[model samples]
Target: MQLILASKSPRRQELLTLMGVDFKVVLKDVDESYPQNLSPAEVAVFIAEKKARAFDEKIEENAIVLTADTIVCVDGLILGKPEGEEHAFEMLSLLSGRKHEVITGVALLQNQKIHSFYEISEVYFKSLEAADIRKYIEDCKPFDKAGAYGIQEWPGLVAIERINGSYTNVVGLPTHRVYQELQKLK
Candidate 1:
């Protein structure tokens, strides 16, 4: 039985490696769109499960396949990856001086069945000025991240005031919870 990871996210790979999991990375494309009625948390789980399903055919009997999706939510709205520099600016500006939630949903497919879970983290940002936003955009240019920011990068030092949950969840994976769940499968 193989342990496969169905994702292309480097952060997820890094976290998995940190846990000493011997796994193979195989990219699986999945529709990220969700029903309009679904909340941001639900959307994350839905997408993660969708990703896991993409690997159904390739899984060996008794193998464990993992997939996950992450999203940033502010005031009930989902903030996805920025389309461009201008969009990054807008996301960062909207997150300024406010509290937002980061949700990550994970799927573990094993024994021909799927198990899923989600984690939510609260983040509070200090007020940011246009200069601050521009400097971050030019410096870190966190265009690849959700909400146009990476909590482990430059803006993380200057913009974040407090966090009420898993710090790694903001980085893209919830390592602690993931570890605990995988141990059960072992």
Candidate 2:
């Protein structure tokens, strides 16, 4: 079966390729808004499922469409992609010396049947100095990443103390779970 990845994220594409999966990237404009009453995990799943559903009429029976959404939650706040430098600074500050949840929701659709699941990884960050945060921000420019940071980047190298779950999930996608789910489809 051919796999269709409905995301433009380079990290997700790279992860899929690393899994030895032959997949094609298909882009669609997906509205990522979720209901406010849902939990962080639910929000992630909702967005992912929403993205998968966008390709409902575009895929064939021999194709499975995969979509995923990643979110960072700390201290009861969901930090989305930072809008600017100040926003990124605030998010990193909030995450300093704390443990946060990195949740990635995945959905697979074939023949209009949808299977969705979420993976949550607990990431512990050591206390980050203001200078370090500024330097990382200036050098990496994390405006496009959720929570204004990438777990596989400089922050992960220095600020992160440990992680309790799938490291790939923290990067963007839960690769092991994704591989397992794809195998089940076969």
**Candidate 2 residue spans exceeding 4 A from truth:** none
Summing lDDT over every window of 10 consecutive residues in candidate 2, give the lowest-scoring window: 55-64
> What TM-score fits each model?
0.95, 0.98
Q: What's the lDDT for residue 161 in model 2?
A: 94
Candidate 2 residue pairs that clash: none
- What's the lDDT for candidate 1? 0.88
Output the TM-score of candidate 2: 0.98
Per-residue lDDT of candidate 2, residues 1-186 (tens digit): 999999999999999999899999999998899999999999999999999999998898869999999999997789999999989999999999999999999999989999999999999999999999988999999998999899889988888999999999999999999999999998
Task: Report residue 183 deviation for candidate 1 (angstroms).
Answer: 1.3
lDDT of 1 by residue, 1-186 (tens): 467888888888988899788889988667788898998989999999988888777777888898988899999999999988899999989999999999999999987688999999999999999988988898887877889998878778878999999999988889999888888887
Clashing pairs in 1: none
